[model samples]
Target: MASITSSGLGSGLNVNDIISQLMEIESQPLTKLQDKAKEAQAKISAIGTLQGALSTFQGRVLSLSSASAYKSLKGSLADTTIGTVSTAVNAQAGSYSLAVTQLAQAHKLKSQSFSSVNAPVGTGSMTIQFGTYDDKGTSGNAADDTFEVNGDKGALTIEIDSTNNTLTGLRDAINAKKAGVTATIVNDGSGYRLLLSSSDSGKANSLKITTDDADGNDTDTAGLSRFSYDPLGTKNLTQTQAAQNAEFQLDGIAISKSSNTVTDVLQGVTLTLQKVSARDTNNAPVATSLNISRDTSGVKTAVEDFVKSYNEFVKSVEGLSFYNKDDNSAGLLNGDYVIRSMQSSIRSTLNQGLGSGSYYQSLGAVGVSFDDKGNMTLDSTKLQKALDTRPEDVASLFAVNGVTSDARVSYVSSTAATQVGSFGVSISSPATRGNFSGLAVANGPITIAEGDNDMLMVAVDGASSGQIKLSPGSYATPAALAAEIQSKINGDSRLKDANAAVTVSYNATSGKFEMSSNKYGAKSNVQITATGSATEATLGFKVAQGGTGSDVVGTINGEPAKGDGQVLTGSGKAEGLKLTITGDTAGEYGTIGFSRGFASKLDQTVTSMLSDNGLLRSRIDGLNRDLKNIGAQGNTVTRRLEDIEKRYRAQFTALDVQIATMNSTSTYLSQQLSMLNNLASGNKK
Candidate 1:
């Protein structure tokens, strides 16, 4: 019969206000939990910021840490119109005076004019060969100018039937074949003409097409034979351009090549002939001088970048570790040991000496220094002067060079080895290979044939093995026969795949034949078995017992070294020490100079810091753990606040009910007392 009453309704004591005040006091732990969560989240965000900055800084550091960074070379031509030059990091810095007398040209031929592109010339098979031609218009010797086509990909034949007898059809058919030559139809004002040209530049790649039509009338100029071009025979097609070699002079030395792009002529240099050199007043070729110089620009930019990156990184670190003066507040990462350790490690790497017998060992020696504010500064003038005077020394300042005591032995690794400084190399026994000795014979012709005289043998190397077969051939001399055998062994696909090779040689003075395996070690050996009448005695091969290969014996710094063929490697104190000793040396031959350049050390430091298990990652992991703990504390505080609020409401409700009951009791007592007083008064009257 009654509605639910409010907490303080009956008491009139403002129980709701009192409960609210008590609940406010109880929520203090929740506020602390919220503040702790915010702090943990802030720390996690700060770590993320640090990780990104460090990764970017590490990337910038890597830009200057490689050999390619320091070995940049720029090639410039005096007259770029004559030709353009390109260079690699390994290109030597020098001036090359080039006089391009002639540029390589491909052969081009045009057919006689026809009525239209759709006109049928007849159907036949066309054989396109390659050769060189002269510009004299007269047919030259075909044998001398003819180029032998490789059966695999060099030679190609196209069939022309009634479907592709037209000029346009022929062009499409040739294009689809992807032959070495391309055919196009040129429509002059009067009629159309079929033009054929070689796809490649060089005298050896000239095009010569021969046709055998269905009419069997090659002499007729109207049939498909009209496309036939034989310099020594029929010449239906007119030679518009003749194939020629590229002729040029480098530093006044005459050089001729089959192609315009000449790479083998110069070490680490590729000369591309664009046009013939212009002639001067005296009729002499005007040389286009190419100046190849070390590109110090990249090095300069790298140094500047290093300074900028280092300064920025240092600023970020200082900002995170700084104490706010206005609010008297410390930063999230203030006084962190990892930050201090990182700063120290970076500074040490920058300050350490190369110790590789270099004139300039430290960054300060090369014009790099840190100021009082901890900002990196570079002296441009000093850096440029050092680069110009002794550029190699400047390079060595940032890159380590593996120098050797003797020119015979040198270190190959620059960073793989952790053991720095010099290490000694000693050779005791020279490397040797397995072989079979042949009978002493004359230098005249030798007969190698199939059937009864066929030679067969097996090459062994670990689990990989293959057979050696010699075909029937007549070699004019014993050396020729040895060469034949060597070629056969090398041409075997299985042996080539297994890296097993044999070297055959014949000595005229000693009258001895030697067949030796190219690989050296106890794991490698050669066994010769007789096949047909080709026994060991007949072919001069010791089949029963073959020669055993031996590994090279050597020591690195008096410690036993491992040997594989001619290469000797060391471990432990002489780790990553590699050398090639083909013969025995009495004692210590040389010392391998091992030095960790500044860039290399910096690279290693940055890599370690940026790795997954790095200091930055570990710090982030710790921050994440704190955040998770803060989340749990927040939930616990929320639950505790809920329980406290419920208890406060129940206590205030009971107090209101008890106050209402006391009021009712007091009213009843007063009414009863009043009735008693009235009755006593009436009785007295």
Candidate 2:
């Protein structure tokens, strides 16, 4: 047995006990800190919850405010304008308009036909497929074949009553023929009849007849029942140039053209001629001469027609609700008014000095408005007064882009006019500092609408992030511009590219941006902006603009972005922006864009706040390792203390027992010795 030593203890405290006490102190503090952190997190989360709710609410209300139905249209017509519009409005500021003053009409080809291709021997039935067939105008039974008629060569049983052929019937039959020719007959009762005619003028609308006589006769001679069979073919009228004329008056000044489709005649209106096919309720041809010729009466009729059309357009526009003010949805004439306004105003005359813009305020002055029915209406009397009193002012009210209407609808004025063809431009990226256009942007040749609102979205970079830019441009013909897009972009490397670092591509159909990454790096981003036809400084249009910086969303911070910056379909890309441009009398140049791409640059922002090598996770890992070390040291010390305590306790118990045994032995020995001494003493006594 061994005795334990107190020397191992200091100040009466065991090393094991002291180590345990230190661990308890450290653990309690850590627990308190954790609880405090969790409480603070809860508070922060509450603030975020409230903010998110308010953001959603505000966004919803603002969206309601911007709906198109809430706005009204107002503007006046002028000599500087075209079409029948007394006035137009700014409802569809960024959209396109197409006023078909004169549309290309299909020509009419009329004729008479036979039942069989080979009208053999007059015993066959007669058929008249009017209007057109197989390139020739005449179809059905021939006039000489319909009735018995004698020709120099032969005779047939069928012949057309040449004297009784009605132009109305002939016209219908010709139209049915679909032969591509127009046919009609004219009569004034001078003993003349069967005046066969075609729908088209010139040789394109010619009449051809086939004839065969019964009994193997070469000429059908029996078809002259209603016709005066003339061997010389005197009744066959040649289809020369149709006398149908295009004529109309502007401000009481008469204008005329031989073609039904007249261009650049009025400032902005194109006139088309359509012969009246149906008579009045009387079911008869207009007693008036088949006057295809342009005359003062024709001019008056054109004016009256224009007035009626203009009024009708107004009525329709006012009737359609785009937004319901009360319900905050669509209204009476809500969505439809804008479209109506666009179509009607596309070719309307603009003001003369509308270039000044301040005086050419709106369409209300010339008399355009959404009547109670939500339909568009025009004030003829007011329009006439404006035209009569301030002809120049009226001109200023309707026609502003140029001296003529064609100049505004088209952009091919001078070489200096913003060349409306394929244009290319690239914007620099703000995030990557590397040129992204070289890698990602697609080669471009995008189509531009003749009017505004058609936006072109341009991207800055495609790698980590990209910017979106909205631009509105125009082209004379989408196809021609598309063909020249890549060439233009390649030719003008400066305008089309950024430091020769970006490739370009434009989807004429989609009109969007495509970017690719060529550079290598970490930090990448893009900035977006919008431009419109009205915004071009050269257009001279009374242009107002917005949405240049409203783009708040960006993506692809450290990931792939495939032109994700897309516009919502119904939400029209440029719908949020407003544009008012004074068109260029010299010409209007539409807007276009270029896409620039950039590669990723090294991005260390995540670890920048802390040590480059130690992020929050690393620090947490380090703490865990330290905790393990502390635990290991504490555990080792604990095990050693336990062994020492056990050994000492055993030693102390044995020592105590041995000491007691020694005392007992000493007591017993002393007793025995005392007895022996007593005995000896007794013996000696």
Q: For each predicted model, how many residue pairs clash, with residues at least 3 apart or on different chains?
A: 0, 154
Every model: Cα RMSD to truth: 7.5, 27.6
- Report how far off residue 405 is in candidate 1 (Å): 5.4
Residue-wise C-alpha lDDT for candidate 1, range 1-685, written one tens digit per residue = 1322798776888777787788889888878877877876777777778777787787777776654566677777888888777777557888878999999988889999989999887898776765444444356644443232221223345679988989998888877766578999998777999999888777766676667688988657867898888765678999898888899999999987878888776666777778899899999999978888878898899889988998898888887888888999987888877688788888888888777445577788778988988899999888887877766556667665555667567455532754666677887876778876776666686677666555565564542334444534455566756654665555455665677777778878877777777777766676664444653544566555467788778887778888887777887776766777655445667776666667767878877876888877777788778778878887887898889888888877777777778777788889999999999999999
lDDT of 2 by residue, 1-685 (tens): 2343443232233534544565555456445545544543443343234233323332332322221211222222222223222112222222122222222233222223323222221232122211111222255534322211101111011232332234344334434544333344434343223344433332222233333222343333344222222222323223332323334433334444434545454323333434422345865332221111111222223233433544553444334434557878752324333243343333232221222322334455756444564444566666555544434333333322111122112111121111111221111121122222211222333334434533223333332111111112333333323222222222222322442122333344454332322222232222223334532322211212111111112111121112211211011221112111223222222332111100000011112212334232343444456556555666666666666566655554455556656666788999999999999999998
The Cα local distance difference test for each model comes to 0.73, 0.31
lDDT of predicted model 2: 0.31
Query: How many angstroms is residue 164 displaced in model 1 relative to the true structure, after the best TM-score fit?
Result: 23
Candidate 1 Cα lDDT to native: 0.73
After superposing candidate 2 on the true structure, give the runs of residues whose Cα lies further than 4 Å from its correct spot. 1-27, 61-70, 73-685
Model 1 lDDT-worst window of ten: 146-155
| Weakest 10 consecutive residues of candidate 2 by summed lDDT | 594-603
- TM-scores of the candidates are 0.72, 0.20
